[model samples]
Target chain A: MSSRREILDLLRENARYTTEDIARQTDFSVEEVAAAIEDFEEAGIVRGYQAVVDWGAVETEDERVRATVELNVALDRETNYGDIADRIAKFPEVTSLRLVSGDYDFDLEVEGDSMREVSHFISDKIAPIPEITQTVTHYIMESYKEQGMEFGDRDDDDRLSVSP
Target chain B: MTFEPADRVDQVPPSGIRRFFELAEEMDDIISLGVGEPDFTAPWAAREAAIASLERGRTSYTANRGKRELRERIARFEADKHELPYDPDEEILVTAGASEGLDLAFRALMNPGDAIAVVQPSYVSYVPDAIFAGAAVVDVPTRSEDEFKLTRDVLESSGAAEADALVYCYPNNPTGATMTGDELAEVAAFCREHDLVVFADEIYADLTYEHEHTSIATLPGMRERTIVFNGFSKAFAMTGFRLGYAMGPPEAIEAMNRIHQYTMLSAPTTAQYAAIEALDSCWEEVQEMTSQYDRRRKYVLSRFEDMGIDCFEAAGAFYAFPKCPWDDADEFAEALLQEEGVAVVPGSAFGEGGSGHLRVSYATGLPDLKEAMSRMESFLE
Candidate 1:
């Protein structure tokens, strides 16, 4: 990818980069940097900054169970994967769905209140479709880091009062 | 209000750099490339330590030489990082920052009328501070033709051999020139031959780009004669926290403490504790910042070269000393600021032989550096 595209992708992860920092990495003129960022924002090419939430933080409260399901599907001129993929995306429990390469054509990240519920949703609701040829589901055992945040050690309150 | 310093203090010509800053303050759109401090915040680990200290009510005054535990940490840190060996209990005096440490060292070492040999194109404080300490300054110009190196030839030709002491800043300010251990061993040998004491400011030691920074004190027979001044300002980005230390022979440290205890009783107690944490765990942060600085340094130097400007390629520190294509730095700098709204310090602010150059700092982030370079491109053309 071009550096500008990479810059936007990096921005998606962290917006703390000053224009000077970006210009250095991107080999762009600092004079034109602010305008470029402004263009990105004004044209809705860039949206807003956000925190990447770790579902594990609130996992206990919701009894959240997440599973990654990989599927190999039949493809030809008569039908396309996008047709069924879009339909599968409408399910509220599916957090993310991507058309991947290799043996599996699609991978769906699904969440549910329990493993039994997720099992039921995948087996009873998704597999009965005509397009599906094979299915595989894997449950996440642990998350050491999520969305660029490290969670190895428990975090403590960091704020302190100022003393003169 | 009585506003009077010792009459001698009034004569320490104010920094020419400050004058350029006056113009910068008046302009709202100025893109500056003239800060000496790092653009990064203190790392989270270091800040976390300070917060922890404050929570424990660590706001009281520390020892005159700072907390013993901190001193030990400083000793270990220096030993581990630079192969410097000093007795922490007797040899380290933690000051407010390198600024205060420099002041203390000067006041402690200089007798009235003593001469201090200082390199030209040096830090602004060196000449003025030496003057304030009631010492005569022997200016030895380090030339761009010679890569801004203060060689034994420059020292001898300038009659600096007769001076009572010498000050050297490696990974130098304004120029960013650094020396190898072999080169410094030769200089250290010269200092020994002349019976000159050395104040080696290694504040920029952690920011060296392509080379390993060699501390002069590490050379044979030099440790006893050299006081290495370093702190948390540049390395750990703890400038406002005001943590610094001086390490040397026990007598020199004691001499400095005599003056230090009377003037400034202690460095910030909380900062002392925080610095202990910094010395222990902030190496990764320092490495990260140094890498960022190294990248910026390469880009800035490449841009200067691409412009066909003659620049001394500095392997250490975060400054680019580039010759201005003009008659004098002050006029050229003023014109650039007025015409392009870019602010940089005139090299003349440094010292003699600095007239045709400008000091551009890469301590600022890259975009500002890029903007400054682009503006200078048009300004120079």
Candidate 2:
């Protein structure tokens, strides 16, 4: 098995699995595991590790809300989808932006304190873009699962304390 | 209150780790590396099959020899994976678990005063089971110098070659050592020369990491003399289901079933149904789990190496037996558990030959293993 692939899979499953842990799991030296991860980072293959959070689970004065904004852009000959997508991706509110196929040219997930805030960001920031022609914003009602992790009850290890 | 228990029950002591288990039970947040079974659950398809069986009200006892369909699948599995062809109709007898199958084999083969040669530093059940069968256990200690493998010389030098029968387990428990086909062929030759009835406990056969497992029954002239015990407990992660089978000559299997019909009546119908599904469609899941275990095996060994502990390379099974730096592994394990909250089985718990070592299981998730290693390093320091 490929050591890099093994390390990648472990990190993908649980990012908290450290380099030392990866070394042990992969039979790679600590230095080798560190170097491989460094190579991955340097090559831009591993962009970043972000925690999958459930914002709704936390009680706060400013409850965070997320929405998916479908953008139908009419790109000029001079400005391609990359230029328009890049402009949309630069916004701090856009958690994920994809140049999707089908009816919408781009699917962007935006997060804010409220639905009105997200709507304003789309109208104020996204709608004013030169290539942007039409926008449809749908506020996310609830998130039961995200990034392959379920938001509800996680499976607990129910094995015995010890056994032969 | 003054009544005495039977000699057979009283003579054999309880499991060596009973005290350790009690101690661990009292402690809080202890990372245990002591379990001898796989951490994974049975595959979804298997569970579904059992549930489906229950829904269909097929909960009655199976045939004493087991459900024929399950036996047929076992036959195919044995033939495909180990190259040992068994007649599902005549040669396979399903029992509660490999533990029960082993006990049945011991009872069927050994008479009073019969000496059964057993490889030491082996599974905990073998010696006691031998005793229960009214047999004497002749210890055949596999040397650590040979990575705990039972070589022909080991058998010859020890009194095992002269014994009435021999019990062999590889991808060994506590040690995680295994033998190659050629190595097993050598032992097979020894068994042939001695006319020894061989009871092969290959419960961990599918979990071998380095090479494919070779059943002793596959070697020439050995099938008639060997009864191979295997189960879904380890390989298919069906420990709680309690499904296992013994494959051997018709007469031996019949002997085992004769006892089984009266004792267990049948392996649980639900487990039999589940095992059928497991053998039918769970090969891919089994392979996935085996790969996971292989990774953990490497990880545990690597940690021991970093700690400067002299651990033999465990080519199979999900354990690492590292030589303890302290004078007594039992003391070391106790102190480590009390102070650092990491639980590992002292090697002495396995047998006399397992003294001054520790069997660290890697069935836990990586995080706990890492925490335990760090705690062990501190304990060593």
Candidate 3:
């Protein structure tokens, strides 16, 4: 009865934990957890587990700039936004895409080596799309929290317990 | 002859729940529904205060009674939340945990051969703590048929009327049973008539659902004789912080504080600061966590009903005690673990009255809880 999504959530939180530990947390047997994880791997529900990196902290000459580009689109009568969403998703620079319910019809997160490179990609590549109307790009200044995790934080949880 | 400890200590059995946990430790890959701790962490404001205090190097102990500001806030909190006014300086002793608070209260109040009536299917600490303090524990079974209320009739029938003091836990552990104010007023009347001191463990007070928790101390003529225990562990999700407090008349608080000073010295200073911050601003977090638990509770109960298992709907705490048709609780618990890799505490661990039942904690994630239910259904079928 445990959902594939729940198992994925646990792996997302801490992938290094053992199958036994995951089972203890998720109420699945080790065999069941192992099987579900195997199914996830086969079905592509999980691609890979990797550490989230902060290049600003480690890299000496990091020049990467990322921006969220909101697109106001005119949906065609045939495939309303699907064709455009597919085309946008195909871009290597696009990190995220969502059909949002705000002033914009689609949201795309794009990254580049510099601001100029990003603007060039938008104006040269994206502006040519016939169904698109307007594009507003917002550059991310810094990230304090991402994916429900606080960055650059000290480990503070394992101390001060006398009982359960 | 070897140096010997007190015979009474040897006479009492180790907690039935302890054996299962020890067994669980020897293996891996078991999904545990037996853990009593909350799944949430202490809220951010509280954690921030603790971090700030550590950076400021405030690691030294506070006064034996605890920090003045924390005690003052607790006093105000009591008055505001429970309508029971307590003098901050004279009537509260902060302990390392509710466990220590219970230990201190028992040692401070019990005389050898004194009798303490403890409700069964209750928290695990009361009986052994009383025994260690040289008191005889009288079992007062709060039958499931009665929805787990310890009424005057239940007390009298179980010989609890003869006891000198009573230990009561509402929003009770294991069973998740709670008593309404009208129900507790009857207990207040009975204790008054029988001249019994009441030890009220309200640790789960803030976790109450659908009904407000009623502290017996606020009942007429009960404040002077009732010793109330509460802590941040359950509501504020600060179990690891190790801070809890006992509130009572000045004499009882003084006795508990004397024991507290000797054994624990003081609760960790960083934790005290964290607790003070939590006390001030963690109500919103408490509400969010409580509502999440409510959703899980309803879901679990509905799952049980769908499976046609008999489960008593709980309005307090995070546990659900369901009656199983199995003849032996320990056997069922063991079989479930062996066959399905799912672990739950047998009801017999709570007390003899809890035999033939099982206690499941909804403090776990929803997916796993659902998995456990399916496992149970398959096992039962």
Candidate 4:
């Protein structure tokens, strides 16, 4: 439903950009930007905007843990991977879910405050699903990159303060 | 200590903004939108090639013209991009930068009292370089109404019709104006009729947004008359490397190399290697940078509109020239810097043709541009 692909791309990069900013950066007017975004939300093309937070970088009372949980399921023709995916997605810890190719049937990325919490959720909530035959959890020790951006130290702009 | 400088040196003024640059340099936390170069670093491929060349100890001076490989690549590049063909061995001479190429062209082609028609609101160097080469400058100013493009009519009115040669730039530095193919054809026809040798500065060729850049050399009968200047500084983000080249008819290029051999000897050897790699692999990077510049150009133009500043659409380069809302652009720039801590080049720094305007560069990051705009908004209020 969103005809303005550039606006979507810009919003995907940084959702914090205002309608005026998006309009300025793209070929749309302010009203057009607002209306296109409205149309996207109405058509369910754009679900929501979220910040790309580096939670590990933040010092807080509760440090978080993350893991990729591979779910292998044997499905009857009527109940597809979508059914098992739907049940697994209901858990708040599952940050991302994808029906991927290769050895894995479904890939689920889960996050929780502690390793124990994440492990417990995988065993208690996900394993109980009848269609899910196997669950393999791999805990992530570090993130060097994320969302097409580097996570840790980045290169500084080393150009001179001014030049012709 | 009492030695006098040459007469040509006295004829030209020192750069207008050295004091302004010194002031900005001494300021604290000033957001600068005054730069005329790309913000991106040189592509990794180019940097790696330079490092590799140094590591290999390829430190010797190249042939007086330049490295054969680099010239071949430049010839192929021009043929592919601008549709102009030149013999690499005979027609191309790599120089320190486009600035050097400009100087070399001026010195090689112009004689004393010969008039060189120069388009104003241009780069800071053109007029002085012409004067240094002993050419009378005819300032042919392009107006905002014409999108700052040079047409045959403007040429006729400005008396450039009588000049011995023409110095022209497109995707112009301060104004960011560009001409269409048909528009360039008119200028080409004018140059052809006047028998003027064309020194076309196409350094901003890749930064064009609205349409594919059309080189003046590609027009009918222009190839023989046009001396094209291009470089890696703006396109490949290789300003520090100081690599640029000139392409033209064999006789003109040979004359340029004659001066180059006595003075520069050759461009940097490592930079030549870097330029080879840049031409070989950095085109995608150039395209990426161009797209980013286009987006920023749109953002700046839109912001100017919202702020009710009169700015012509910058169809090409990364800078935007907006008419100063205040009476004097220089005073406005100084006041803005002192009050809001934002630095922009006053338009008069370019030429009298650019007076009453401010050259706002969008070469900085978007966040800085946004912040600068907000500060400018406050200053205006």
Candidate 5:
């Protein structure tokens, strides 16, 4: 089996396993496992690896919340819009910025302490740009599917190929 | 709406300061003073508290504003330290950091075409943030002779009283400059007369060397209009922990908190718990650290003087903004980094009036600072 397939099978069974552990289990060298991981990363197939520390075990606090910012840009000021988007993208507070359609010109994912901080970005940072005319910010109260979790029991007998 | 091809988007210019820091990060064997991050870890007690919270399974979404205990502790801290009384329930808010607090203030208070006054050579975030809020930022330039302290004359001359809000940061970033009680009073008086909302960023207040940190809200009549931003990042070396708080009028706090509630939901729960312990158990450690910073500040100043590089004695914070011996601060900083493995941020990265100056943080240990000074001297020679 290709290294990619082997890694994927290991991850599918245990997404939280360390690279070294995965390599050992899959009978691959650590460097090979690392290379396979990098390939997965480059292909955008494997976005990231996170330690899924149980919220219950780590702390009984509420789960982390996510917020989205909808930005409205001017049609005539295309150059200015890109400039604005690029600038917004660079902010440490902003997680992602995507050019979108409908009433808004773009959608942004902002991570911060509270909605006030997010609205401040929308009002004080995002909306005030010469290119940005309007903005509507939505705070995510909860997430049913976050970081893309797949549901269902794994088929132990079937060999699955992982594409990079 | 389906748009015309010409109406797509544009990319903005890179933040000059951020760009410089990124470059500094790439170089091997670089002794960087480029970053504004605090050097020390979040106090061990604070970190331990956070870990304890994690062990206790306290990781859930907190109240939108923050945990009640954290807010209450912040209120107590402010009152005891600065004589600013705030109601934890209505007048105080916990934020990701002072950065977010400033952003929230601008969003809550500013409207398009409204003007805001900022002290020049201030933190880079103020200008961009004000601009983003649709407010025209009027820069009030402070001079080296004045120790870069914001004065009533400069504030009035800049037409800050006419602005929708006045954004002030003391024990300021980059410069390590602070305002005296009288100076703050004068500005407060002026703002009161002009009906200007005062957004005070006092993140570095606890790091003052010469005197105690005083809040504008401490002045009579000022508390009603002043919104103070402070956090644990600097004094407690909790930058990575990302905990801060804002205090202001009930109405204004409510507005900002509403936005915060809708957007952030709450600050990290574990961090908030840790912050409570930080405020409660960490004053002695803070004093010790501040004393050490003062010593470093003196050493760095003497080094600048020895090098014939004019620098004002910083009375607060851990940065020394020294006049560069060269004409262009950017070029000088680059040369220092490339030739001597020393990294300092160009003053221009902060704002206008910052050219020909460099901000060198003394957050590193005494030995490293001594070595950097030696490297700097050799490079200059």
Candidate 6:
């Protein structure tokens, strides 16, 4: 039986392990390893690959204030959630969007130092849209963990592997 | 293709809490005092109970409301501690945490456009959850001079008598203030007169240093109108276990349980078992931890005072909200974390009237607290 440990062992030994290498390590046939990899990918056990870059080379600001903007929009209006999301997506500062079940229709992630920068984006750029009715912003004070390493480091072996 | 996509769903904004947390994550060497969680591990009895439950093959889901014994223990605890008698079978429901309890209460009681009167500088969840429930929130700001206490005057001034619900948090979160028996009686009277349903969060009740926590439900005529929310997370140091309960009138309890059944069948079974043990054998441990927190609280208050920061001694909870010498708490917190490696949440994070203050959690060990205070002193200097 192909156990989870065997699969993880193969991946840990070589994150870029080919099907042949996996088969050699786990004593499975190349075709079987390839099929298993396909299954893992489909199950989202293998997420996308990332190229590690040295922070010294990036030259980007390391830290700034982060806030979530919850927006309420008019349903029948021309400037709908899609229109507003598209507009927000174009802004370099907007990081992500999540559709939540309650309160607001959409939650936007924005980055800046001063409230003025955030207010300017909300009042001048976002709120001016005809479909947008109201917005509430919650500034995050401190985070114990963030998206990348913390989420990726879950003990569960349910993540997908993606080839670079 | 069908007709063009809807305009509204795309127009919604993002979450502000998520953004601030990201900046907090980036700062290196920052000693965060901003987290809401208590630093202690789950009491040994509770932890052992959970382990035993898992070993005994009780990993599957419990009843939607919760394990019978756990609910019974909660009911007994409430009746004994606060004199709020509740029938476990009819008047208590388990939730993921007090957070979920608050959410379930709102969902069960509020309809769109209903008004929810919330005390300002309260837990971040109340107003947001009220908004999420499609209710307009009317904020009643309490003064620092009053130690941020929620008095009957504040409730009356907010015109919450006409509101569908009044939300209160005592042994409160950001500000560590609490209400006395007499104060709660006044609140109970106001709610009774106005026919307003009260959602009382007493999560930090067990941590009071100077005074005992008095539940509004304990007062005459208040049991029918008040829903008391308490949890193992704070008192038993079981933040990770995510167990809490609500006690209210049978009808309100039934409504909340319906939502709980649909959304979350129950709190984790292991957590329920653990919580049962917590109620049985965890009081002494809680008192010990509370003592430790009390010491840290005093130390932090004095340190802030020495640094020329104005602060009031918190009566309960493990936080110290100190007025920032700099007018902007967010900026001060950001600078402290970046320069001195000490992190505290900006007071504005809690809501209006919190602008110039910073919330410093004394939940860490004494050594860490000392180091953090020293760093804070240097930063202020």
Write one digit per residue (lDDT tens) for candidate 5, span A53-117: 32223363544445787777765634765776778898888888998777777899987666667
DockQ scores of all models, one per candidate: 0.07, 0.51, 0.07, 0.50, 0.01, 0.01
Q: List runs of model 2 lying over 4 Å from the truth.
A: A67-112, A116-145, B1-3
- Every model's TM-score: 0.75, 0.88, 0.77, 0.89, 0.68, 0.67
Q: For model 1, how does the per-residue alpha-carbon lDDT over B1-381 read when each residue is reduced to its tens digit?
A: 888997778888877877777777777767777777777788788888889989988788888999999999988888988899889889999999988898889989899899999988888888888988999999888888888877888888888889989997888888889888888877888899999999999998888866688999999898988999999988898877888999999999999999999999999887887788888888898987886787677678878877998897787877888888787778988898889988778888888667788888887766677788889898778
Task: Choose the strongest candidate by DockQ.
Answer: 2
Model 2 has an lDDT value of 0.89
**What 10-residue stretch in candidate 1 chain B is worst by lDDT?**
B28-37
Of 1 and 2, which scores higher on DockQ?
2
- Tell me which of candidates 2 and 5 scores higher on lDDT: 2
Which regions in candidate 6 have their CA more than 4 angstroms from the true location?
A1-164, B1-17
> Which residue pairs in model 4 clash with each other?
none
Clashes of 3: 0
Tell me the lDDT of model 3 at A6. Answer: 58
Chain A TM-score of candidate 6 vs. true chain A: 0.54
Query: Model 6 TM-score?
Result: 0.67
Which sections of candidate 3 miss by over 4 Å? A1-65, A68-117, A121-164, B1-3
Better of 3 and 4 by lDDT: 4
Give fnat of each prediction, in order. Answer: 0.02, 0.62, 0.02, 0.54, 0.00, 0.00
CA shift of B275, model 2, Å: 2.4
lDDT of 6 by residue, B293-345 (tens): 76567667766766888888788888888788798777887787778877777
Best by TM-score: 4
